[model samples]
Target: MTSASGFLHSLPMRQLRGVGPALAEKLAKLGINTVEDLLFLLPRQYEDRSQITPFGALIPGMTTLAEGEVKLADIALGRRRALLVRLRDHTGGLTLRFYHFRQSQKESYRPGLRVRVFGEVRLGPLGPEMVHPEVEFLSEETASPESGLTATLTPIYPLVDGLTQRRLRELMARALPLLDQTDALVDVLPARSSGGWTLADALRYVHAPPLDSDRRRLLAGEHPAQQRLAFEELVAHQLSLLQRRQRQRQWPAPACTDSAQLSEQFLHQLPFQLTHGQQTVLHEIRHDLQQPTPMLRLVQGDVGSGKTVVAALAACPVLAAGYQVAIMAPTEILAEQHRQRFQSWFEPLGIPVGWLAGKVTGKARQTQLNSIASGECRLVTGTHALFQDSVQFARLGLVIIDEQHRFGVEQRLALTRRGLASGFAPHQLIMTATPIPRTLAMSAYGDLDTSVIQGLPPGRQPIQTVVLPATRRDDLITRIAHHVASGQQVYWVCTLIEDNEQIQAQAAEVAADLLRESLPHLAIGLIHGQLKAADKAAIMAAFASGQIAVLVATTVIEVGVDVPNASLMVIENPERLGLSQLHQLRGRVGRGSAASFCVLLYQTPLSGLGRERLQILRDSQDGFVIAEKDLSLRGPGEVLGTRQTGDISFRMADLLRDQHLLEPARVLAEHLMRDNARLEQALLQRWVAEKDHYATV
Candidate 1:
């Protein structure tokens, strides 16, 4: 084994030459703490200084290489002191300016010395000048003395505060040769794999490719070397998801085999019949519940797709078998909404409905806790408080999570564990109103089986969406007054609650006041994030009961605030929100039989992307289609909410462009885990370094 491959992977950056505390600190900012990390820091671009051009023919904005002899070197003073060197070739003369220099540095640029310079040229007070250019002094023993230039492909790396491209390229040059002497570093991929390359070779090519390599492909992230690295990263991620699912399934779950009695009773009592999509998904959930292993299923449906009914019906099996069921929501309002719905449906059947939340306190809270612990709270609904350590279940059997994307993976896993009673894990059913595209679901939720509700229930009305400029403010106000006077409710959504000054979004308070002045006969209410939970609940309740004609609120009412009577929605600066958010807001109305409409009021001079987003919303009411378009337009992070939302995130692989690699990588991951433990471990160690907990496969 050679020095580079033998120990370089574990070598600290501080051990490298010229990497003192200061330089190492600067490098650390770029996440380069080890020799291996430094090796992986490929050049962001390259400079073609291979051909030397005449000093007189150099273009001002073009970077070129030139050889010249130093005529005079001295210190010049203006607003600041500087060392200036005058160099001349046969065609023209150029000046080299250095703002900070020592006397010894000036000595190196003495007269009668041949030097090579590479940099962008600019017209200064003197002739074309190259400010602080890279200078290489030529000596008698220098290999390129005739040209006085290093005629090679120059790799330019990204640098930090105290680092320079030249210094980094030199470090790469020193490290590259060491790998040629060692055979310890091995390729993780099998030789049979197509487009495979040795790990060491890939590193060398990416850091310092030949001048003839494909630059276009490199810039577009289509280079063979880059594809190989991306594919490897995707496989590691897929393996992590597969292994997590496997680990979770190893625990036993209580089998609700005799849920027919409970399901029939619950289904017969529904006010309306279930949609075909809902029935199909419910069947899938019931199938998973009877299995010995824990059920990890995701139920995705658009807003108003009857997901709440499906969730309640799915729990009847677990509830009837003398075990507890827990339902978790993302927000207090959503949780309370679920509580009311469940209480209305279940209390008639003599079953108890337990409600708990951050706001639920005193004797009521203790009573709910006791009911949960004493096996009396057969079914429970609440926010994150349901998973708190103080809350326990006597024989927890099933766990249902609503708006699951809004919760973190740790939170979900903790709730899953809360259902573990007597070595039996609970059946887990996670629901999300934000429809996920097929490619995204395959990559992000590969570990769980997915069932999607593709259609809304009967009697649902398609929302009429329109894009209007804010100039129609007066017209919109008149329209709103007419709708409210006709016994219809309105949701006037404001993106901000207070004046941001930086943003032009209409604040909730300002919008409410404007509406009140325009239509003084209508009762308007305001709600935003800054308002207390009790206040928000009260305002939402009032708006739902039709006491408030116009409900001016922020995104707080984006989800789980159901008011079937609200048929008009006026969104101010709708372009400020994402497509999914805009879709969710549109869904708030159009729930009732009355003709519904959504007015997207936008500020003028919209951006291209913003226009595209609004246009997409205006064209489609299908959440799935809108979601796919949103993913393409906004990328995954914003579409998935945030890093705190516990959705899947990839650092190197992109779901939009690299989605083609997901299914194949997922297949390969399953094979590796089942047949090749050594290779799987190697891949996890190489790519999924810090995410080892999820890579236990």
Candidate 2:
């Protein structure tokens, strides 16, 4: 039962005791292989049938177990190809109907046969029926009352095509013993603070709860054991991020002498005054740029918090110091948007700016590339196309990445390395509109100098977020018509289009179609991810120019599209979106003097999480607050979509729950590195090796 050093390195499908070739293939499809993976393959849900009641006591739609005698076995052709079997207990009669049951099952359903059925029980014409109930035979030796019923919470593991719940349970049972043995070995957090529970205790408690309340508590993520495990995962993540930050800190940056003067000029040139938050963050950025070490800073602000302006101010010092600056965005549209904004800001100051992206082609792209290479383009902005082999910068000093989460670790490193190639690494600024929870920021962006813009501009209007049920579509459309009539631009976001152009597009089209009929005179433009590059750009241009009064779009406009005239954002099916997304959508409005409004339209009977998402939007416009709530509700994984990429790499830690673990882990990492750099390096190497081996197996 002990964990061997190379145990996780072995192919899991091959080592699983009862897994045959066919079952192994199925396990592979579920990404379950090796002992480690199987151990960590936590159940998606747990069904509690431990308190099994009698058939008569069971309510319709309530999952309960029923033991009965097969009074009759009738093979009658049912509507739409179904087979019906009627069974009766001493107190009640129930029918078992199967749509695809074969003739072979008939022999087992003899009149005298005793069977145990586990599924939902519904009232039928004669009495009650269980449709496609999981069945098992009853024997004298195994006829304990609990035998007919699930005596404990049944752990429902994630499944694959050919894998069954039974098979997954069996495999999990076998793997549990092995996992338990290594529970002591896997200790990453201190035992005292972990509520006196070991990892083994947590796993056992999660899988086999002794009571119904315990099952509920464990699944709800309130159990101490679960918290311990989550902490361990967070500790590992924090340690990794801290290490990355430390490594980046070692990189040298050329100190810019003109930083203060440039920053002053950038601020002076702005049309509006900077918010206190913006000024504080810009000061932090200025301080970082003044340091000899390259600045690996993350500027996180809510949508429309004027983050780009802060970034512009940071870039000014590098540009003024005769060093070229480059900004990379996640999408072409965002890139174009940044390009235009930078042009507007810099062109007035006579600072040359260049644009490059996937769509930028032929002579224009070539000319931009030449400008960048010759240092004629002091400020270059584009998508990942900026990292293409042909693109080069004469003296790149500052690299700003917008929506940093969209790009991977390698991509960020590639841009940073470009600056280092010439022996002069640039100051790095990573920006995101998605407000990361504080704990997550510590774990995910620990290496970066973090700056948060918590306030909006002085004259910025707060977007009023309102939640409306889908039944009030007519009222909402009328409101939109009224807004359109006033010449204020509106962004109607859809969750899906007719052809799946984007999930948002479908919702946008429905709203657009309805709005078109209501306000036929207003110019309406449809834009989505599936549209051609030129078309999207054209649509965006028309909207920005006020030619299009209403623009129907997907989440594509969530990041950098700026139209001060657009005062309203109607997000249809807002329940389908995350809190961060909803916040971003709302940010599209309230950028100008016009009083902006955000209508969050959702279908009735919303889920608990859905309601929480909408409520979070309605309650606050602060991205940080929304982000914390998002982490609490959805966990860090879903909140940030952190996968294998270094952006979001926590394996088990819930940021909302384990915020305390981050600083300790970060400090420990630094202390470890300081005491023995080689030891720290070796540990990181081991972790990476283990991760690679885990991926391969």
* lDDT of each residue in 1-697, candidate 2, tens digit only: 4232324435456776888788777776756656655666665467766654566776788877677788877676655676677677667777888877778887678887778878887887667788888887888876677663555678777666667787777787777776544332344335686778876677776666665546565666667766766655554455566655656667677787663776776678777888899989988988888888888788888887888888888888888888889989988898888888888888878887788888889999888889888888889888889878787778889999888878766677677767776677788888899998877777666666788888777767888989999898889878988887887989988874243555555556776787788788888898888788788888899999999988988888888888999999888887877788788778888888999999988989998878877887899988888888887877777677654243554335556656776776666566755675544543343232233212110
Residue pairs in collision within model 2: 12-34, 245-447, 494-504, 494-507, 494-508, 495-503, 495-504, 496-503, 496-506, 497-506
Residue 127 C-alpha lDDT in model 2: 70
lDDT of each: 0.81, 0.75
Please list all clashing residue pairs in model 1, or write none if there are none.
Answer: none
lDDT minimum window of 10 residues, candidate 2: 688-697
Number of the top TM-score candidate: 1
For model 1, the superposed segments whose C-alpha errors exceed 4 Å read 1-171, 178-183, 190-193, 196-198, 420-422, 496-506, 644-652, 690-697
* Per-residue lDDT of model 1, residues 241-325, tens digit only: 7888888888888888864887888878888998899989988998888888888899999989999999998898888778888
| lDDT accuracy of residue 646 in candidate 2 | 38
Q: Compute each candidate's TM-score over C-alphas.
A: 0.83, 0.78
Give the number of the best model, judged by lDDT: 1
